[model samples]
Target: MGLLDNLKARLAPAKGKVSHLAHEHGHKVTHGLDRAAKAVDEKTKGKYSDRIHTGTDKAKGAVDRLAHKDEPPAGGGDTFTPPRTPPPAS
Candidate 1:
């Protein structure tokens, strides 16, 4: 295999382990993210509150994605449809 392929092969196991850990300790990870964000915001005296909030949200999203990587998609993979569409009113 090429260099890139070999690297991917080796890292596959580590990636699986990380996904598992993220799933198991996802709550702790999210809590830590919040705590760190709060500390930084306090240190900056709220000057970067917006940016810090955005970063914290993104980090939490990433953690959730990793933790649920193996789960089925939201809505159970079903296409959504609007309910009770009004009949054509002439």
Candidate 2:
């Protein structure tokens, strides 16, 4: 096997463990992130509110994505739907 493939194979179990932990502790992680962000923002006297909020949002999104990595995508299996047009008023 190639070096990269070997590395991936070795790390597969670790990745699974991480995914499981993230799924189980996702809510607590999110709550901790919120609390940390609030504390940091307060310490900085809101000078970095926008950046803090953005970072917190990205971190939460990452956690959510990781926690749901094994789940199928919403609307099911790579399906796409085009937006429907509204009917004109009579």
Candidate 3:
């Protein structure tokens, strides 16, 4: 096996543990992220509020993915459909 494969093999066992921990403490993790973001925003005087919000959202998403809570529904209709917009009258 190549370097990446070997590394993945070694880390395979830890994946389950990480997922379990994330599932158990996901709310606490999210609360901590919010608290940290609020502190940073206060320190920055709201200068980077937008960027901080974005980063916080991405972090939360990562946590959800780690906890496997982002999985698609078991019903299997996972496709996305764009909303239709009506054309303006000429």
Best by lDDT: 3
Task: Judging by TM-score against the true structure, name the best candidate.
Answer: 3
- Where model 2 places Cα greater than 4 Å from the true spot, the runs are 1-3, 73-90
lDDT by residue for model 3 (28-89), tens: 99999999999999999999999999999999999999999988878776887676987678
TM-score of 1: 0.75
Q: Which wins on TM-score, candidate 1 or candidate 2?
A: 1
Superposed by TM-score, candidate 1 places the C-alpha of residue 66 at a distance from the truth, in angstroms, of: 1.0
Clashes of each: 0, 0, 0
- Model 1 worst lDDT run, 10 consecutive residues: 69-78
What pairs collide in candidate 3?
A: none
Between which residue pairs do clashes occur in model 1?
A: none
TM-score, candidate 3, is 0.79
Q: For each candidate, give its TM-score against the true structure.
A: 0.75, 0.71, 0.79
